[model samples]
Target: MTTLLLAAKAAVAVLLLASGGAKLADLAGFAGTVRLFAPARSSGWVVAAVRHAAVMIAAAELMVGAVSLCWPALTWVNLAVLTLTCGFVIAAGLGYARHRGRPCHCFGALTKRGFGLSSLLRAAVVLAAAIASCMPVRPAPQLHFTLVFHLLLLAGAVLMAAAAAAAAKALLTQPDSAGTVA
Candidate 1:
C-alpha cells in the first residue's frame, strides 16, 4: 500500500512538472488556449492580463510539483496536487464541450492531441492518482531526506522542465505538412 501510494505521488508530481515546463515554453500559445474560456476580448490590457495568468498557472504547477517531490511527507502537498488535478478536469471538460478538435497544448508541442474523450480520460486518470495518493496508509517507517538529496531532487526537476521546453521548441520549429516552417 505504501509503495502504491508513493508511486501515485511521484506520478502526479512528475506530470505537473512536465506540464508546467511545457506551457512555459510557449506562453503565447497557452494564452491563446486560455482565451477560448475567457470572457474578455483578446486585445489591449486584457491580452496582457491573460499572458500573466498563463505565467502564474505554469509557475504554480512547477512550484507545487517541485515541493511535493522534495517533501513527500508533507501531507498538505497532496491537497495541492488534488486541487490542480481538479482544474485539469474542468479544462478537459470545457475543451471538449466548446472546443472539440482543437489542440489543447496540454503538453505544449510535445503532442498535437486535441480535446476529446481521450483528454477527459487522461485527466480522470491523473485525478484518480492524486486521490489515491492522498489516501491514508498504515503507519510506516517515515522516510527522511538529507539536504543533499533534496537538492538532487530539485536539480532533476529543473532538468525535466528544461527538457520539456527544448522538445516543445524543437517541435515548433519543425516544418508543417505543407513543408512550410511553422
Candidate 2:
C-alpha cells in the first residue's frame, strides 16, 4: 500500500512539475489563452501580472507534490492539492462542454492540448487516485473524519485563491516591454 501511494505521488508530482514548468517558461501563450477566459485580459498590467503569478503557483503545487512523495506520511497534504486540482479540471470540462471544442490550456499554452470528455475523465481518475491514497493513510476511524478532510480543503481554497488574487492584482498593474500597457 505504501509503495503504491509513493508511486502515485511521484507520478503526480512529476506530471504537475513538468506542466507547471512549461507554463512558467511561456507567459505569452498562457496570457493569450487566459485572455480568452479572464474578464480583464485586455488590461496589460492585469495580463502580465496574472501570467507570472499563475506560473509561480503552478510551480509551488508541483514542488509540494514532489516533497510529499518523499514522505508518504505527508499524504494528507495531497488531500488539498487533489481537491483543488479536481475542481480546476471539472471547471475546464464545463467550459469545454459549453464551447463544444475549446483548447484546454490546463497544462499551459505550450502543450496545445484541448479540453473535452477526455479531460474530464482524466480529472476523475486523478481524484480517485487521491481519494484511494487517503484511504490507507487514515485507516483509523476517527482520524479520517470529515472535519479533518474539510479543514484541508479550506486551506487549499485559501491558498489557491490568494495566489490567484495576487496574480490578478499584478496583471492589473504591469506594463509592456515598451512601457506601454500590455
Candidate 3:
C-alpha cells in the first residue's frame, strides 16, 4: 500500500514538474495561449497580466511537485494535487466549450492540441490518481523496489515531456490552409 501511494505521489510530481518546466521554458508562448483564453481584449495590461499569471501558475505547479517529491507522506501535498487537478479540469472544460478551435497550448510549446474532451479526460485521470494517492492505506516500510519504480516513472515523464516539445515544434510551426498558425 505504501509503495502504491509513493508511486502515485511520484507520478504526479513528475507530471507537475514537467508541466511547470515546459511553461517556464516558453513563457512567451504560454502568454499567447493565455491571451487566447482571456475574455478581455488584448492590450498591454492584459498581456502583462497574462504573462505574470502564467509564471505564477508554473511556479505553483513546481512547488507542489517539489513538496510531493520531498514529503510523500504529507497528506496536504496530495490534497493540493487533487485541488489543482480539479481546477485544471474545470478550466479546460470551460476553455473547450468557449474556444472551440484555439490551440490548447497546454504543455507550453510541447503541443498545439486544442482544449476539448481529451483535456477534460486527461485532467480527470490525474484527479483520480491524486484522489487514490490521498486515500488512507496501511503504512509499510519503503522498499528499494519503490525507489526504482518511481525513478523509472520519472524518467518516463521526462521522455513524454520531450516528445511533446518535439511534436509541438514540428506541428505548430506549420500554417493552416488559411495561412494562420494552427
Pick the TM-score winner. 1
Order of candidates by TM-score, top first? 1, 3, 2
Where does model 2 exceed 4 Å of error? 1-3, 40-42, 138-182
| Greater-lDDT candidate between 1 and 2 | 1
Off by over 4 Å in 1: 40-43, 175-182
Which scores higher on TM-score, 1 or 3? 1
Give the Cα error of residue 21 in candidate 2, in Å: 1.9
If scored against the real structure, what TM-score would every candidate get? 0.90, 0.61, 0.74
- Point out where model 3 deviates above 4 Å: 140-182
What tens-digit string does per-residue lDDT give for candidate 3 at 1-182?
66676677778777887777677666777777677767666668877889999888877887787667655656777888888888788778887788755666667766656777888788888877788878775643342236666576456655655654455455545553222466
Name the best candidate (by lDDT).
Answer: 1
- Model 1, residue 96: C-alpha shift (Å): 0.7
lDDT of each: 0.84, 0.56, 0.71
Count: clashes, candidate 3: 0
Model 1 scores a TM of 0.90
In candidate 3, the residue pairs with backbone N, CA or C atoms under 3 Å apart (3 or more residues apart, or in different chains) clash, namely none
lDDT of 2 at 47: 75
lDDT of 1 by residue, 77-134 (tens): 8899999999999999999999887778788777778789999999999999999988
